[model samples]
Target: MKSKTPFIIILLVLAVAIGGAWYLKKAATSQGHGAISNRTPASNTTPPPATAGVNGAEPPHTLGPTSAKVHLEEFGDFECPPCGLLHPILQQMQTEFSDRLQITFREFPLVPTHQHAMAAASAAEAAALQGKFWEMHDLLYEHQKDWHEVFDVRPIFEGYAKQIGLDVERYKRDVNSDPVADRIIQDGKRGHYLGVKGTPTVFLNGREVPFESLPADKLRVLINSELSGSK
Candidate 1:
């Protein structure tokens, strides 16, 4: 026999290398493809009541009424693909539920991971100063693919501001203002306090909802559940 010992050793080494590769791949996959992976204890299970009302330094972008039975608070990163996907669904929900659903958007830009996220938040906040936040918000999501990867996004954002009837000159200044920066920081702090670890983390009726339940159909069911129970 040609020394079975050597063959056995080679097989063992190969097995270890294969196992290592598999583990690394699985780790990467768990980080999520679009949204940042959820690291909080809130995912897939109901958590404690979320902090109620506007907790940021500035008034958050809100749709519908405060008296609505179901309040949906979304902590989102503009450059996050999953957040972009959730945008339209939430808009539709707002239309369907009308005054019954209150939607509040909070900025939670993931820097480094998403290079343009902070800039996008700045654009929205700047637009808010012009009383056109919702318009800029919609444009950001609608044209996310256009600007997220550009070398510089200021021009694109300025274009959006102008399109929304803002004074582009003021928008340019406000985008870099202390107040704009402060608002983003404040929202991020609130997210951290709430144990949020990813983009598109949503709270429905002060309870964190699972990522799996974020789709239009599933979310509709959740909203309905909240509405019925509030009665």
Candidate 2:
């Protein structure tokens, strides 16, 4: 999957997704479709607000209190393979820290690289309209490969919506509506502004952490320390 991506797609995603070419290209280009500049990033110590933000994105799909000491923010593309790998881990974290941790998700669709990214984002947003965003999110990621490269995905999205108990008519209408499209675009733009360059870009307490560096157990330990004011 990584090798199949064209050079341009790698360049575009590099602005925010994890890729080798992205770091090299970032210093050279400042103007393009995925250019990110003057990013503030985030501090590791403090939790960012649930409202407006300067260091990073404050996506609306929060699962805990605005006042929670631990904030885990993920800027992910629905069809990105690495993001799919992180999905189950995130679910486990969400369950384990349901009371003390707040999770915020924002879309960062790699439209140039992933053909169905925008459509998948739209589908999730449509589910969101009916308070079923997380359901659709899980469905899409769980079955990512089934529709990853497929051009026509509306029917698949609609089927998932039905399985989740959403009104199929409304889901279909919302999926094609202006609001859903705009929301996905807005999410991606915000993610780009935060120096997001790939799927599964994560922020812990507003600071971006290396997912590879901190495995789930270590991350859980970090969270516990934060909650205990040990850090």
Candidate 2, residues 38-115, lDDT tens digits: the string is: 222233334433234443322477777877778877888888998998888888888998878888888888878999
Candidate 1, residues 55-140, lDDT tens digits: the string is: 76567789999999988989998899999999999999999999999998999999889999999999999999889989999999
Best by lDDT: 1
TM-scores for all predictions? 0.79, 0.73
lDDT of 2: 0.73
Write down the TM-score for model 1.
Answer: 0.79
Global lDDT of each model?
Answer: 0.84, 0.73
Model 1: how far is 33 from its true place, Å?
23
Alpha carbon lDDT at 100, candidate 2: 80
> Where does the lowest 10-residue lDDT sum fall in candidate 2?
31-40
* Most accurate candidate by TM-score: 1
Off by over 4 Å in 2: 1-59
Score residue 51 of candidate 2 by CA lDDT: 32
Could you tell me the lDDT of residue 63 within candidate 1?
Answer: 97
